[model samples]
Target chain A: MKNTDKSAATARPAPGSCSPGPFSNAKGPDHRGQAFTRPGSGQCMKRNSILDAAARTFCRDGFTGTSIDLIAAEAGVSRQTIYNHYRDKEMLFGAVVDEIIGRMNAVLYGILATFPEKPDNLEADLVLFATRLGKNCMCNQDGEFLRKLIQAEGERYPELFAIWRENGPARVWSAIAARLARLAHCGALDIDDPDLAARQFMALINTDLQFCGMLGEKPTEKQIEDGARNGVRTFLRAFASRGNPSTKADPAVKPNMALF
Target chain B: MKNTDKSAATARPAPGSCSPGPFSNAKGPDHRGQAFTRPGSGQCMKRNSILDAAARTFCRDGFTGTSIDLIAAEAGVSRQTIYNHYRDKEMLFGAVVDEIIGRMNAVLYGILATFPEKPDNLEADLVLFATRLGKNCMCNQDGEFLRKLIQAEGERYPELFAIWRENGPARVWSAIAARLARLAHCGALDIDDPDLAARQFMALINTDLQFCGMLGEKPTEKQIEDGARNGVRTFLRAFASRGNPSTKADPAVKPNMALF
Candidate 1:
């Protein structure tokens, strides 16, 4: 069975699990898996450690719902350490958004990397791509974290919406658009405007799958996989250029725009 | 010149203005050149008047920004009248959303009616149709109101999104999809999934024009009209199976999909 354990620090095995080498001392018991920890002076490392803990806590509880004392206690540090890093609650909340968006991008990019640069079969390529996207969107706890972050920040800090637009969806859109453009250029697909095509494909997936998942109705893993395959099939059929011996071909179809 | 006047009610008939007819009597005296007078006396008439005013106010100010008192004053009715009609703020908001959506649909349908049902020149038909749509999105205040409504209510009330999905964009999509399907059936266009093509066309317009307008950084009206025309042009060239003899001669390549 697949492990769904969420403790980010220890989600993977010890360094020895793969093949322990010269860096084994770094993976010692005091490692604690804290991202903020540094090798030199312990003071700065301790400050970041508190910030990391605060982020996890705020992800679970909202800005108003969480207290500095709780964050301090969870981080195994004093409340003064958190105050040293962040001036107040608002500042801390901003930090949390930054951290969440960064983590989400990392996870998304990791999944997207699974697809080949150019695949032999269009259908197989699309199915593989969509399946990965669907799985990450639904099963990943970080997806919930991003959703809750948007919901909470949208209420209090409206500017976070603009930040999210720039970093989150906009970034993802550009990445997808580039991939589509590459495919269109290689004659894998007959697309006049790659960016527009990419947006439509995304809308199809989000409308059919992600939106439903956001409604608190979780589909099984098999269901997600199947749904992705179907979506890709529909998309490819709509976009593929059918070779037909027909009448006058007014061939003025332009290539993908360079604006993206 | 386009009329830029803003009058609630007025006399001295404005040139280049369509007669609102009965609704004109309900407006203020400045534009129509008349004194303020109540048209009907019954409770139902009075209730409808209040609703009209509330709808106008909700269009101007958002749901949270508006209040019972402003609505009452605008309708020339007491606050008790509003309470009598709507149970609470949420009910009033829902009614306003419905009213605005109705008006939007009316405008879009009116524009569609101006075009021939089946134009001999499909390119000209699409250009004209898209020009009209671009005008509504870029040149009118309705687009701004729509963006606000979507941004404000999209989170708390998914029903609002559903309404737009089902009635506004969805209807337009189905209209285009049906046309594509008919063309495919007649072997005029090489399409497998007309619905997906329709969605893709809509997505092109939305991302290129609607998104810019919503962001309040829109290009000039002429730019929008031209952009939309180009979008339709590219879409047709890419999807229409009209004169590609090479595509039909290939036995190895499957024609996209055979759903249509």
Candidate 2:
């Protein structure tokens, strides 16, 4: 199962080909004499590849069924290489969980940052925000992998999930809630509980997508757009401050009125 | 593994006894002349016990990990008895899915029937309705079982989940949509899309509970009530018609005003 070239193994750098050594500056030449751009970067690339392979394997096979060998094969690395990075299967799984959670949190916060801090049009801006959220956070590979992992293994590893909850949903919700509170403070919304509103906001955005995801189907762009549009409309209707006359009145009556 | 005849099992009839036969009225004796009340009820009793055991095992172990023997052991029935009813493990899983879906559908429709046709106080009525929905449909055993099954095995058995989608969410959404449409027609709500409203309605109610459920923790009655109360308030805010004088103004401002 070892794929490292025999010649390359003999000519390995002092740090070892798969070892993540801080001083490894130049990725030593492979058996084919192809030199990697940097020393440490090659090891980082291999580590990332292993994580990607592990995520796919875990999502597909679940925790109990996934074997380290399967992941090694999928990553095109030797089992020893994987063990060199992660001590065991459980440790690898934990790393995978951390990688996924960290990536999702980054993506979620990135999307949250774009949430109309100063919107010219509340409904339109919200729709755009929600759509980006759907595409960047929910419909993406990281989102799908993390969701499947949580569903498949949440019960088996409660401590891991507790950390996930803290870093994932809890933090995301608070960040969004802060944004909503800012909007409400600006007299754009009348939300009483920014936290609850944030939760409801996500829930509404996911209404259609959640059902599709449950059946293991990725939602289409059109479906995502429609869900966002409808969700934002209802959300605006519910929270738009009475002082914002353009949105305070039912948008259904004057649908074209822009609320800047 | 068979504990069907320990003193604990015999004394378990009040809640644990698996007997479901109508004729086995007394639940008194076993075939050893322990005076089981009646005849013919044993078959029905055995069937229900098997289903209950199957649901629990399937939800806990997932589809691939679960086996007929595990279910049989859990149900305290022989493997032959299980085969007598279910042709195989897949068939038994199908039966469990069917049983859960049927029971949940019945309960959902029963609660749907209690939706206020013409509410004098829309917010209060909706809170009560939402609370009942959370309690009877979502937090119950059948709902939990169905959710876990759908999440764990929906991808492997697409056809099963397709049917589930049609019979479960689709039907439920349409039913709630019809109710919302009726309220809109009565000028109590300004809903443009009853379908979207219905989806959002359920989504909001499940926000907190969904988070807890993901972490494998059951939400308390207080949590459920809070979710429902908050969800209904937001729902009403979004949909209550401008012409409905009682709800046209912000309810928070006049918190004590009784629209009823």
Question: lDDT (0-100) at residue A89 of candidate 2?
Answer: 81
lDDT of each residue in A1-260, candidate 1, tens digit only: 22223222222222122221211122222423353344573654454455556555555555554788877665556766566556666766665555555556766778667654673666666667777876775345556555555544354466755665566555665677788788777766766556556655655444334323433344556655555654555456546655521112322111211110
lDDT of 1 by residue, B1-260 (tens): 21123111211123112222122235662322122235545654555555566655654455555688887777677776566656666776775565556557778777755543453566567667777876874345555456555544455577755666466665765677787787667665676557656655654444445334322244566556655655555555556565743222212111211110
Give me the runs in candidate 2 sitting further than 4 Å from their true place: A1-47, A67-73, A76-85, A243-260, B1-43, B78-81, B243-260
Residue range A136-193, candidate 2, lDDT tens digits: 7788777777777776778778777677667776676778889899989888888877
Off by over 4 Å in 1: A1-96, A134-159, A180-260, B1-87, B111-119, B134-170, B209-227, B230-234, B244-260
**With candidate 1 superimposed using the best TM-score fit, by how many Å does residue B101's alpha carbon deviate from the native?**
2.1
> What TM-score goes with each of the models?
0.54, 0.77
